[model samples]
Every structure is written in structure tokens, then in C-alpha cells.
Target: MSDRPMTTTPPRPPAGGGLFGRGPFAGAGMLVEKSMSFWPSTRRLMRRLAPERARITVVLVLALIGVVLSVIGPRLLGWATDMIFDGVIGKQLPSGITKEQAVAAARAAGDDSFADMLSRMDVVPGRGVDFGALGTLVVWAVVLYVATSVFAWLQGYILNDVVQRTVYRLRSDVEDKLNRLPLRFFDGQPRGELLSRVTNDIDNVSQTLQQTMSQLLTSLLTVIGVLAMMFVISPLLALIALVTIPLSMVVTKQVAKRSQKLFVAQWTHTGTLNAHIEEAFTGHELVKVFGRRPEVEQAFQDRNEELFKASFGAQFISGIIMPTMTFIGNLNYVAIAVVGSIRVATGTMSLGDVQAFVQYSQQFTQPLTRVASMANLLQSGVASAERVFELLDAEEQEPDPADPVPPASRRGRVEFEHVSFRYEPEQPLIEDLSLVAEPGHTVAIVGPTGAGKTTLVNLILRFYELDSGRITLDGVDVTAMRREDLRSHIGMVLQDTWLFGGTIRENIAYGNPRATEEEILAAAQATFVDRFVRTLPDGYDTVIDEEGGNVSAGEKQLLTIARAFLSDPSLLILDEATSSVDTRTEVLVQHAMAALRSDRTSFVIAHRLSTIRDADLILVMDAGRIVEHGTHDELLAAQGAYHRLYAAQFSGALVTDDDEVSGEEEVAGVRG
Candidate 1:
């Protein structure tokens, strides 16, 4: 509401920030110090995937089939190994001797332990190696392996499709949420922070889902299948492998708890850094003019350092899981090997069963390691999801009426009856203010800094809702009309010109897409845009950059004016429209405005006294109230607030009853 131009400032972190004391290593220290809503956010993220449950169910079934086939292959290979071992042993024995005879012979030769091992071996002493049976086992193992791979591939392919579609819906919802949010919601938010949520955070979520979804599913199912096989082979070895599980879990839990906080900090710092960069680049010219590049660079460095520390700490802590898991897995392997070998020597278990158990133990431990390693990615993804959910859950504007009331006619008559408003609840900016702009009248509003000049026009456009009373356009309450329908009949020309990246003709056509080419040319000529366009090589086809740097400030203002001229609205709001134009251009703009204002209600907010001298009615505002309202000449004759403002402009000094200028009064005079 201040008279100063409304500009967005970059968000900054608080000084002496974070849980740790400010130091070079403070960012690192704070990484694991802050806590987040990890479980709640993760649950909500899971809920976001609910719509893809059908595809997920299909993937789960495939993964289960693949894991079952995979586990069966190792067992089949174990069988083949047993057949080869038996054949080799039988070939070494006498050709017609039975297995019992060999054991008895060994026992008689004073080799009881050897006899015991020979009794456990399933060997036909009279037979050589059976190549046909061995080959059949090997062939079956290969087939199972191939089938397992095919199932895994199909599941992975389907999972990827599900993830992509989920992310697509999320992006679309975010875009729609932005449109539904009220203008006030954006007032306190930084543009870059919002952009980071929509672009960067959402992208991180997509990548996390893509990388972890199928892998996590497959790993978990493999662990189950492998564990069941190990038990079937040898319960003792299975129990040994199970011991390592608790140790692996303890390590994973500790690391994940620490890394979750770090990942949250990392994403938070990313958003802050993005906000600073956006603000810096947006106002780069101002920074250079003020010689504040070093300051901006220092701020960027501080945020970048914070992000770096958080990221490093997260990756480093989470990286601990794999090596620690590998160590525990090795211990399990040693225990299983020693026990299985002893059991084999004792003639209580076959060598092939022990071999299969060893393979199953490795398979079980490998999946555990994969799951542990994925903890960091899961945490990071949930952090980003929480941020996105916050945006999606923001309070939206009140909905439009179910059945909107259209205006009785398109005659531009606006009324503000007992309207009250405030940016903050405790500090009122406008209170019980009333005004009327009759049809086809030019109302000039002149006010000092912080005198609610901009807020007044903003209220007319329904950019904000009044705390009390109502605004009407053509005898119908504005609130009863849909916002789009109400704004369609109004045109605005702001001091800060805005043009998208497009040709000059396209920018003008943005005002009225249905406007004919001849009408567009007429509007441009009326606003003197064609005069400059003719000078350029491309004329109306000249392209404007994203920042519109190709055109001068005056030319930009002229183009905006031409756009407003093309709209031909019933009501026009011009807020310092001529502030950026040169004196010569101002004359042309003033003439164009005069023609544009014909038979239309117009509100002009200006600080320059000369610009509004010819206005039909001049309203002088001070401290949220209108102190004087009348014709310019009548106000000058009265020699009140408007007269003093006019006198200050022409005489360059404010004269008061006390014949002395107070600082506050002097500032008001200068601003007026």
C-alpha cells in the first residue's frame, strides 16, 4: 500500500541461524541437529501413488514370480554339483563295489571317520559320472534363470510407466493449485522458492521414484525367497544368517535417522539459494547501479556453502550403510561356512545342501544391503515431497458465486461504499472509505508515500477483498460476478511494463486476441508505437526478449499503452502510466490517453501535479482518508491539501501556518 513501487525482495536466512552456533562448520553441525516430519511426509508420499495401485499390483506379482524362479535356480545348480561330486567319487571307487561295501571296507581298514563320510555320500560305486542327468539339471537352471530375468524386466518396465504417470499428475495438480491460490498467498512467497518446488523438488521426487521403486520391490522379495530357501536347506545356517540381520538393521536405522535431517537441510538450503539467485538476476541492474555485487556474491556463497555441507553430510552418513552391511554379511558367511563344513564332516548334511545354503545366505545379505543403501534416496525424496505438499495444501481463494450476477449495462460506473481493508489485522490501512466514479469521468487520485495510493486502485480491480462493505461495477456487486467476467471489461496500464517473449504484434494482440490487424495498427498508431516500430527493421514483427532488453523503457511503456488501447474496456486504471516516458513522449501519451478515456470511467494514480491538472475531479488523500475532492481549480482556490501540494510542486518549498517545514511534512510535499 506504500507509494513506493511494489517490488519483491529475495528471501534471506536469519542471522545467527540454525541450531548450531554460527561458525565455519556450523552448517555441518546443524545437518543432523534438525528434525523433520519424516514418517508423516513419507506416508503422504505413498498415498500419492494410490491411483497407480493396479499397475503396482501387477509389478508385485511379477517380482514375486521372478524371485521364486531365481531362488529355485540356485537349488537346481546345487543339485547338479551334487551329481558331479557323486560321479567323481564313484569313478574313484572299485567298479562292482556297492556303497555299503565301500563303507565297510573303509571301516575295516581303520578309517572310521572316512567310512562315516562315505556313508553320507549318495554314490553308486559301480557307476561312472552320469553326464545326461548333469546336463539336464544345468539346462533347467539356465531356463529358470532366463525366466527370472524376463519377469524382472517386465516388472521394471511397468513400474517405470507407473512412476512417470504419477509424476505427470502431480505436476498438473501443482500447476492447477497455483492458479487457485489467492494473490495474498503469493505476497509473502518468493518467486524462486515457488519455482524450486514446482521444478526442482518435483524433479527430485520423479527421479527418486524411478530409481528406487522397482529396485526396492525386487530386493525385498529376493530377501524373502532367499530366506525361505536357506531354512529349507539347513535351519542352523539360516539362523546364523538371521543373526546378521539385527546388526544390519541397527546400523541402517542409526544412519538413516541422521541422514534424514541432513537431506531435509540440503533441500531447504537449495530453495534458499534458488531464491537468492532469482532475486539477484531479476534486479541485477539495480545491484550494479548500487555497487552491491560483492554483497550479493557473499550472500550466495553463504547459502551455497550451507547447501554443500548438508549434501555432503547426508551422502557421507548414508554411505556408511553399505560397507557396514558388507562386514556383517562377511561374518555371517564365515559362521555359515565353518558350521556347514563341520556338519558335512560329521555326516549329518550333504555338501550340495551346504553349498546351496551359502548361496542363499549371500542372496539374503545382498538384498539387505541394497535396501539399506536406498535409505538416503528415500529420505531425500520425502523431504522434497513435504515441500510440494505444503504448496498444494495452501489455502485457496474463496470460490466465485454459483450463479454470477452480470452487470445491467456496460456503462462504467464504479462505487465504493464504506469499504474497509488492511494488509494486517491490527494495523488498518484504509477504513470506511467511500468514493464514486460516475460514468465517463476521469478521476485523478494524488497522494504521498504510504498514503494507500496503489491499494486504492488494487481494490477497484478486486485484487483483494474488502474487510467490510462492497464494490460495484455498473450497479452490480463485484463479488457477485465471476472474477474473470469482471476483469474482462477492465483494462490496466501499470508503471512497470510487462511483455512476454514474443514479437511486438503478438504482445499487442495479447490484449484482444480477436482484434483485427487493422484495429491493432490503429491502436499502435494512436499510442505512437507505430512511429518507433516503423524505425525498426522488423516494424511490428520485432521480437522482444524475456527481459524485454531489446527495447528502451519508453518504448516498452508505449507498447503497453497500445495494448490497453486495443482492449477498449469500459473502465481503465492507469497507475503512473507516464512516469517512465520522456517529456515529448509524455505529451503524445497524454493525448492518446485522452482519446482512450472517451466515454469510459478512468482512475489515474499520479504523483506529478501537472499531469492531473485537467482531470474532471481531483481527490487529495492523506493517511488513508480523502481530505479534499473537487475540480482542480476549485481545490486550488480553496488552498487546502490539494493547493499546498500544487504550491509545493511549483514553488519547490512548502509553506505552512507555522512558516516551518517539519521532516514528515517535507517528505509528503516532495512525494506529492
Candidate 2:
């Protein structure tokens, strides 16, 4: 492992200057720059989901046009408000409005004295400012409002398309990565935690891009345009409005910095809670059998409470940003009103200019508040991104060397030459030991529990790497063989059978996708699994629950046997294959194993000594070493470790070479 520990850094903005401005935008560009450095992966994802760059370009162009029109149209509305007042109340109507028109409009206005007051409010002594063309401005303002509405709708259309496609592609890429990850990558990590990466983390990114970014873009554009308009109308008032901008920004940054850690904690706890729930549900039988209901419930409640506290802290901190921003905005608004009043009273600024400045101040502050809040969502998004990237960055299992030397022909022979292994380096599970199984022979291994029987099988298949020594197949080093091709020729039926949530046919066919219905039925019959399948309501079509929960342990094991039979691999590893079944089911499993191993090398780790008495070889193992090995009768004749174990099981029973029965004693039952 690297010396660096896993930790999240604070989200920084773009590195280069922003397209429109500096500060946060420039920081945002820096972030984009960092993300772009992983362009090969990002580009692949983008191309897969979007497929068409032209569509993206079109959407962005339309969005830009919409933003421009929307900004310009709102200003036209303010312009028309001033123009309408000038025409109807200030007695400065254009040529079309007569004295009769003003009187009629005044009476029709009714309780709208505010309009008349607004008209009277604008004045500039000793300044020649004509208001005769105000009627034309009103018509133009109405047109601008309609245009702005149309552009806003167009922007929505473009943004929605881009966001949905981006989400679709991101999800697809995550699923693909999950499929390609090796089995060792899954060890110790809960399925629920992995599932959250595909579901919850991606949802966070989507929410940011859709709702947060949309609001962010609008607020940014409005602030820029409003500031420019204010600067044009009165730089003094614009400066006054801009004074509060930095304070609001500082508050927002503080809120984001304080709340980000809390949000990350909350999401992490959510994953832990999910893992706990899934484990409880999956192990419900074990919990009940062990009478651990209270223990399980308390464990769940502990994780739940942690999640709740973290969420509360995060949300409570985030909620404060909006109100705090509102308070600052109101204060700035009051300052602008007072300053504008002084300037207007001194005849330095017109009423129209003051109104525009106030509007601009509101525009500036509202987006500032929006940008602040969006910072919260963006922070959450970045936190999620960090987790997802970490998963993607995990080291993959080393692949087999390239250009592997192929065998002249695959013979059912396997040899372990001084193989030693450890699940963890501090404790070795398998010592430096060697063993071999000849072609078409059955080798039965009996060992005390934790004596590494299963670990031995796991090594042969290369499910794990041996720390020392080599495993060979057909006299060739298996490590030099391609993993896919190496495993393709080996069949495994683990003690615990796992069936996906699908139909019985699907479960059996999983071993070989191209297997026909006839082939599946034959294999099922051969394994005696068809007896139970036929009793089900849907027969072969019955759907199995995850882990084969819908079926009994015996039936599930039998189906797994049927799957292995269908595969018909040359080398078979049956790791406690019938340990979960009753004697009757065990008989059927033995029959299936016998038939399957007829012409193939087989390794059986059996608890029932009676099951493997006819094996060509038997190895008695204890504490990671082969204490005794020979043919069953030869070992009994030697009267060594195997002799003592057999004598203890069938005490005083006379034995003959012709007799097929052997003592039903395994290594763990009589440890020596």
C-alpha cells in the first residue's frame, strides 16, 4: 500500500480563469481541469451515453441564446415601467396620446395611485431628458417579456436533454466496471455498499448537474448582466450594491467548508446502515437460530442513530446558508435605498436610474445567495465523486503472464508442488506441502476443521495466489496459463451453493449459456435434482430467490451439482459438496459425483468416510500437513494415523480386503 492514507481534499474550483469571471469560477475551471486529466475514461463514458456531440453543441448554443434574451427582456420591462408612467401620469405622452387619453387612463387606473406616484417620482431639474417616446418603450418591453419567456423554456429543454443523457451514460459506465471487477475485489466489502456506488452516488451527481447547475448558471448570468447594467446607470450605486457581495461570498464559503465533512459522514453512515440491514435480512435464520434478535436490533439501531445524527448536523448547517444570505441581502437593499435617496435628492441621479440600481442590487444578491446554496450541493457531489473514484482506482488482481504456453492436450491431472499460502501474511493456512491427482483418479482429502481443505481447493483454481510453490495442470505450471482458459476446464461445486434470483432453467443454464433445454433436463436427472424440480408448481420454470432461499439446502446443492454436470469440466473440485444434505440426498450426490468423475480427475473433501472408501487415493491431513496418504485399504494395513482413526469409528469390526465398507470416520471426528 502507498504511504498516503485515504482522505478527501476540499473541492477547488476551475484552475484556469472562468469563461465569464474570476474567483470561484476560476476555481471551478481548475476542478474541470483536474477531471479532464482523466479524459480517456471520461471520454469513453461520454461517447457511450451521448454518442452525438452535435446534439450537445446545439443544446449549449440554444441555452446561451435563451440566457441572453431572458436577461435583456427583464431590463426592457423596467424600461417600459418608466416609459408608461411618463406617458400616462407625467403628462409626457407621445404624439398619439391626447389630453383626453390621460384623463381616461387616470380614472381607469382607480386605486393604483402608486403608478401615478412612481411617474411623479422621477425628475431632474435643469437637465433636458425627453419622455415623449415612452409609448414606444412600453410596446418594446411587452415584446421583451414574451421573448424572455420563450428563451427560458428553450433553455429548459436544452438543459434537460444534456442532464438526462449524462446521467444515463454515467450509470452505464459504473455497471460495466462492476461486471469486470474480479472476485477478490468483492471480499469483505458488503454488497449494499457496492450497490450504493451504482445507485446513490450517481444520483447525487445527477441532482447537482440538473437542479444545482441550472440554478447556478441562471444566477451567474443574471449577476453579471445586472452588475453591468448598474455600472452603466450609476457606478456609485453599483459600487454600493457590490460592497455586500464579498461578505455574502465569505459566509457561503464558510458554510460549505463547515458542512462538507458532515455530509460525507452522513453518506458514509447511510452505506453502513444499508450494509447492516442487508446482512440482517440475509442472515435472519442464523440470527433466530442463535436467538440473537435483540443483538441484531441493537446493532441496527446503533448504525441508524449514527446516520440520523450525521444527517441532522449536515442539513441543519446547510439550512442556515439561505436565511443568513437573506439577512445580508436585506441589509444591502436598505443601504442601496438610502444611498440612492441622497443621490437623487441632490439631483445627481434620476428616479429611473435609482429604480434600475435597486433592481440590479436585488439581482446581484439573489444569485449570490443561489451560488452559495448551490455550493452545498456541489460539495456533496464532490464528496460522492471522491468515493466513486476511489472504488474505480482500486488495484485489480494481477493478470496471468502474456503468451502462455498451451498444453499439448488437456489431461485430467493436477499437481501441487510445495504449495504454501496465507489469507493474511501473519498466519499461514497451508504449509509447504505437495500432492498430486493422476488422470481419471479420485483423491479424497480428509482434514480437521480449519485444516485448510477448502483453502487447498481454492488454490488449485487460482481463486487465490499461493505465497510459495507452484500448482500445475497436465505437468504445465498453471500460473502460466490464462485465467479464463484455466478455469474453463475446471468445475467447482462449493459447500455453499449460490443461485441468482431467476428461473430454475436460468440457474442451471448459467454453467453453460448455450446448453439446450434437453441438455439441462438430462443433467438435472443425472444429479437427481429433476425429482424436486418436477414437484414444484412451475417445474423447471420456477424462479429461485437469491441464494436459492426458495429451495431447501439439499435441493439447492443438487441443482448446483446439475450445473457442474452440465459443464462437464475435466478436473472437478467438490468441496464438502454434500455436507448440508441428509443421508438420502447425500446418496444421490455421491451417485452424481461418481458418474461425473468417471473419466476425469476428482478432488473430494468429504466428512463421510463411507463416501470415498473406493477412491484411488486418500490423504489424511492435520494442521496444514499431509500426515498420512495411501489407498484406503493400504492405509488401514499400514495401521498408522488412518488405521487408528478407522479402528476408533468401527471398533471390533472385522475387516477384509474384499470388503468395500470403510469406517465412517473423518479427520476432524478423531483428531490425532
Best candidate (score: TM-score): 1
What is candidate 1's local distance difference test score? Answer: 0.83
Question: Candidate 1: TM-score?
Answer: 0.90
> What TM-score do all the candidates reach, one by one?
0.90, 0.80
Distance from true location, Cα of 408 in model 1, Å: 3.0
lDDT string for model 1 (1-672, tens) is 123222222222333122222422222222222444789887888888999999999999999999999999889988887888888888889988789999999999998877887788899986877999999989999999999989989998999999999999999999999988987777656666678889999999999999998888888889889988888888888888999878988999999888888888888788777777787777677778877778678877988889999899999999999899988889999999999999887777778888888889889999898889898898889888888898898999888999999998888999988877777666677777788999889999997766777788888777788999889999999999998889988999999999999999999998999999999999999999998999999988999998899999999999888998799999988899888888898988888888878889999999887788779888887767677899887887676778777767766777576643453356445446
lDDT of 1 at 642: 82
How well does candidate 1 score on lDDT at residue 229? 87
Which stretches of model 1 miss by more than 4 angstroms? 1-36, 110-113, 653-672
Every candidate's lDDT: 0.83, 0.70
